[model samples]
Target: EEALRGLKMAMKADSPAKDTAAIVIEPVLGEGGFYAAPASFLKEIRKICDENGILMIADEVQSGFGRTGKMFAVEHSGVEPDIMTMAKSMADGMPISAIVGTDTVMDSSGPNSLGGTYTGSPTACAAALAVFDVFKEEDILGKSQRLGDKLRKRFDQWQEQFPHVDNVRNLGPMAAIELVTDKTSKEPRADFAAAVTKKAKENGLILLSCGMYGNTIRFLMPVTIEDNILEEGLAIVEQALKEIG
Candidate 1:
């Protein structure tokens, strides 16, 4: 509710309402920590966009294609966006992106109206099609959900064991752990997060840190990772935490 109020206030403070065109949001914030927006907040945003005659664009580049145990993160909110942009896992690193929109909005432009220098490359399309085939054949969504459960369990254990490990969260396999000075104060411990990532890297695990205060260690492991490999990587993270915590 506070977030919605802030949005409304910002929109009102934008001066001319006619200048507003669309409200773009990431259903699950990627680079700004792995926080998933509440479903109610998303629904409210949809209503606001409809009432204000503004298009709602969902940026699903990081949270799309079964990353969140769903086809798209917005699907969890049951909110249909006016426009959606997807990439990253779409082609499994084939360097392709796509934009989808409602028929009314899409048809507003003439055929062949949208084109980029490398738009609609045949190779990239083939890679994307292959990816879809693999998704159906391998039950990727189910694997993602199971992976998320495993990650959440591990994070919970870490939170209980380590004093600095706080605010462990995830939207399916997109998980993160925030390092703080203490549980009561909740002061961000950017140094701890950096040290852990550096130690993890030295121990043969690639870990990334994100968030506004750079105290968040986000996990972006592949859904198809083998059980042994996943455990090995997680063990490395635990070792790093023990050494740095």
Candidate 2:
């Protein structure tokens, strides 16, 4: 995203900050919006960070591990992050988080510095590993790609049919639609967004809404969801949108 790119440039410009630089970002800006940053932007930022000795940090809490058609969203760009943070769905809601980094960066931190009381406790790790196995065995990553594609097509259909829908986008299972009264002005229609989300929940689609302006509906389908179930959820959304429109 431009935020990371701009931060990198700002660091280079600031003599003091330049020496202490760490570029943190979400490859797929989730709550800010369910939009995936262009891969080209990611590549440029990676090159800039490398040349400037800055570390690129990807917040994959919302876009990692079978969520973005890749094991990790970083695979979309093929540019490795110096440090990647994760965990929202690592183990069936068994709260966990991690900071994966290069050996050098990891070694920089001392021993016994980051583990939690539950960190790496056998049960969680074993369960997470089992989830990983299921993901691979069931081709969950491929399903994510198809799910995103289906979501985009459905979103586009809504956008074309409904004038109030300003934009529709998909990033793996993270798809969203924005409502606007003035398409040219792109003024957020928060009322419409909230009302539809409420209706969708009533109609059986447990959607979430969180954007800078609170005018977007976000969907995060479980990667392991069956096609019939996924379609059922989307159908609920479509019905809700129809009623709201």
Candidate 3:
């Protein structure tokens, strides 16, 4: 809250900071190591935005569409923003994105002031609609919760056994393990994470790295993956880690 107030102060008269427009953030950081913004932080942001006239934008590019076992990650914090941006999983693999906002905010712009050549491309729109159908029929949100539970359990165990696994964080099924050189230093070991990802791929389990130092193993597996397949992939990861050791 203090940090937020300080930021607001920076935008005051004669301040070096330019006049503020809006604050955009990912409810659950994606490439930033699957870090989920704390509920308190999100609520504080909303409060600050409301106190001022600043618009709050939730960028749900990777955390929307049941990825975090919710329709949108902001739902977890129960903080609704003035605007929400969604993409990536919205249309599955299709090229599409959406900007949803209150009618008043949306209508503030003149018709000629806001238009995209592919704003409503039929193919992308159709794909997004299909994704909604799948979500409804398959109960994607429920699946995400189940998958998250399963993965979290294993991650907890891994953290206990591997001293290198500095942190295990997740929002529903969007999970990640941060690597460190040692518990005391907690220094990110990017090389170790990169090697683990490469080794996992060699063992038939693909993994990705992220975070400031690229020392985090982030998981983006589909929530609908078969149980056996999920288990097998995890096994491969375990094997790869053991081999790397």
User: Highest lDDT, which number?
Assistant: 1
Q: Where is model 1 more than 4 Å wrong at Cα? A: none
Candidate 1 lDDT, 185-243, residue by residue in tens: 99999999999999999989989999999999999888899999999999999999998
Clashes of each: 0, 0, 0
Better of 1 and 2 by lDDT: 1
Score each candidate by Cα lDDT: 0.93, 0.81, 0.86
Ranking by lDDT: 1, 3, 2
Tens-digit lDDT track of model 3 for 1-245: 67566756766744432356788999988888899988898898888778777889999989999999998999999999999988889998788888899998998988687665557689999999999999999999999999999989999988887778868988889999888887789999999898899988877787899988999999879989999999999998777666656
Name every residue pair that clashes in candidate 2. Answer: none
Which 10-residue window in model 3 sums to the lowest lDDT?
A: 11-20
The TM-scores of all predictions, comma-separated, are: 0.97, 0.90, 0.92
Q: Write the per-residue lDDT of candidate 2 for residues 54-147, one digit (tens) a residue.
A: 7889889878877888888888888899999888677656666677999988998887787765685787777778878888788888888888
- After superposition on all C-alphas, the RMSD of every candidate to the true structure, in Å, is 1.1, 2.2, 2.2
